[model samples]
Target: MTEFQTIHPLGDVPPQSVESGDTSGITLNVRHEISMVQIFARNGREMELAKKLNIEGVPGRASETRSFTAFPLAPGQWMLVSKNAPGSGFGTGIAKKLKGIGYVSEQSDSRVCIRVSGSQARELLARGCRLDLHQSVASKGFCAQTPMAQVGVLLHQVNDGPTYDLYVYSGFARSFWEWLAHTAGQFGYSRGGRGH
Candidate 1:
């Protein structure tokens, strides 16, 4: 059997930034390929299933895990994210482990992630997102699904630096990337081709 290798949508590109007289910000990196899974309750048994699985359970709306992130997508549904963990096949492994507790589907290649951070991160995001990204409201671990630049995305505020991880459909990856790059251009931004 031939082993299919995973790939980062953007690889080793380097950061792009513009600095003019002390005002500078915006940094973007294509997060490294990691295992991602979407798990949904099989029969309105979300809470039960989550509890049985044991990894931070399913997150509440607008919340995420500090160690291994799990973001709620809707009632009875959540997406599990493992950053920098080995290769793919996690979803299948999880399904086998759960064994009929919940329905698990692989999302490793179905979506692409972009990490943006810095002082200007929130400011840049405000231009295209309607979510209230205020530190007090969107503190670390806050997560939401919203339309950014007219594209549906899973947004997570990951830290005090107000860094954010934006996950979008792989099909729309390039479009989303262009929008992010162009929006951040005004404040001078940097880009990383590979590894979050």
Candidate 2:
């Protein structure tokens, strides 16, 4: 591997050349592999770690995109997530600074998170979602636990760019893609509509 290997080859995650799809031209695409890392710490430790890391927000989050929705899930319980997968030392950086004890896990396989946002964001969701995502309830940083087309799902309502994030098990991407494709057709009937 060079300094950086252009992946998109054969793997559980994504390889190198994932393409932009266009059942209707909205162009659905994603990284071959979803990168995940989990931080396991006791209750009080999260707050302390957040303070030390200046926990203003989750890292690698991209909500703003002219007109879109990008919300975060409260950085929830695991403490935090970085743009890049951080290992033991990354956790230790905070652990040492904050004087706390905890464990860091690189969880690239356990869960698969897909970012979904675009002109026809809502339309694609209508394909297989049961949740009512109106303006008031589906605001930025807000999330809902629901299933898509029978699969368990965690939907994060974002503001600006990424309208939503679909969290599902690694085993269900193909079916989910099929579901999205069906609904996305209606969404792309007129082209990506500018809304979240």
Candidate 3:
């Protein structure tokens, strides 16, 4: 967890409310790796977590009733989330009770994350992605894996009502976010969607 801090997305774009400049909100606090820790359950338990989530998990789960957290999808499988230290508690705890589980590692520190909102979010994302961000395709709480700016990106379409969570690698973060802000300019974007 990180305390939110004000930041600037681009050199020319003034601060906007729709975008949060906090590095913690966008970039993982990870001391090692590239982004953050992302866990996907492969065994029955993890599948359960995916279904309960009501949204898509990276590796995905078998059914909505099946649930697992912080577990691995399979051998050598990886998940992303904020990882500076160790976070096996979320997965290990569940694995202890699971019958057949696999390896789980956090790659959050290995990547970067950003929250893209504001009225222009859909248009901004269109600059890099082909996913239909409309409500029909981008239902709240939905998660999708796609490329943004030619880099791997995990798009978390949270049902935060109207907010969206965009995550990428620290390396790609600076450029990727800048593109988002540039596109958002048309819909009138501000930090966190508030206003300058």
TM-score of 1: 0.82
Compute the lDDT for candidate 1: 0.74
TM-score of each: 0.82, 0.58, 0.55
lDDT of 2 at 95: 41
lDDT of 3 at 13: 31
TM-score, model 3 to reference: 0.55
The lDDT of each candidate is 0.74, 0.51, 0.48
Q: Any runs in candidate 2 off by more than 4 Å, and if so which?
A: 1-27, 32-34, 56-76, 79-81, 85-99, 189-196
Candidate 2 C-alpha lDDT tens digits along 6-112: 43221332321212433333445443433454454456565554444444335333233222222233453342333444233444444454444445555445455
- Clash number for candidate 3: 43
Judged by TM-score, which candidate is best? 1
Flag regions of model 3 displaced more than 4 Å. 1-36, 40-100, 190-196
How does model 2 score by TM-score? Answer: 0.58
Q: How would you encode candidate 1's per-residue C-alpha lDDT over 1-196 as one tens digit per residue?
A: 9998755555544644423312566777777657788888877677776676554443434434443567888777888888645455567667886786688888877888888887898998999999898876778878888899888999988787868889998888878888888888788654334532
Best first by lDDT, ranked: 1, 2, 3
- Give the top-scoring candidate (lDDT): 1
